[model samples]
Target: MKNLPQKVRSKKLSSRVDLTAMVSVSFLLIIFFMVAAELRKPKVMDLSLPYYDPKWDNIITCSIGVDNRIITVLLDDNNRIVTYSGLLFYPIESPKILSYGKNGIRKELEKRRKNILEYSASMGKPKNGPIIIIKPSKKSNFKNLVDILDEMAITKIDTYAIVNDFTPEEEKLLASK
Candidate 1:
């Protein structure tokens, strides 16, 4: 009786695992990394060069050198600033020696621009305005060039040139400064 008559029983258990939460967490981590790994944008300055035109004969050249000096000249037999219409050169005003800033070079530029506008209006000619040529000397640093460019923007100058070559007069002026 002890050996033959016992009934056998077995217990059942589930072997499955819930992977939804794990998969969701993995996707969230992936998305977080993707969102956080974006690259930064670089800063830059925009500059435009003036197009050549026979009608645009009037040119204003500003030479920037070291020692915080700028020599502004208009294209003529004598390098001088133009005072009014008919290409009148202001012999009294030799390329004004100016420093950098709102009070210094910026003020001078605004005044010059104002003069050009007045001259064009009086002459009954469409205001092409004076074409500014920026010439930076070897002694001039990058900061000086950038400051001048900022001045150009602040002054609302639409036509300008960044000339690499300097005239003999400009060289002398730069040397003197």
Candidate 2:
């Protein structure tokens, strides 16, 4: 028998998957999420605190002047706000319990502001706004303070202070309520 030539065999090719597109897409999604998170930030409110100095303590104690423009607000428990004009001992406006909102403290603020402006102008003094002294009692919540501060901002009040110290008279007055 004559020998036959061996048949040539074809080589099989191996299948491969391209991962470049998938990697790029995953990276793009990550970047997009990061940028979105950066753009969304929490809103903040600005506060201006008084600067303290040791040397001014003596000077403050010695100074004696009646400022009718001063308004003191005391924040007590149960969302009670006690407000008065001038010194607590010699108040121009008697201490009154006021609630929150436009009809409450806001109305009083606007009325006092207008009166103060008129009084200052008539006295031949520079048109100065009312000075608010916010005294938050220990029993009061933080929200009360923030709400009052918001009121000050809404009324366009420029001069205000957040004082923690309370006199004996103020304590007794708050106790009565």
TM-score of each: 0.49, 0.63
lDDT winner among the candidates?
2
Q: Stretches of candidate 1 above 4 Å error? A: 1-92
- Predicted model with the maximum TM-score: 2
Task: Give me the displacement of residue 90 in model 2, in angstroms.
Answer: 1.1
lDDT of 2 by residue, 20-114 (tens): 99999999999999998988877676333344447656323212222578899999998889999987756788999999899999999999989
Clash counts per candidate, in order, are 0, 0
lDDT of each: 0.56, 0.85
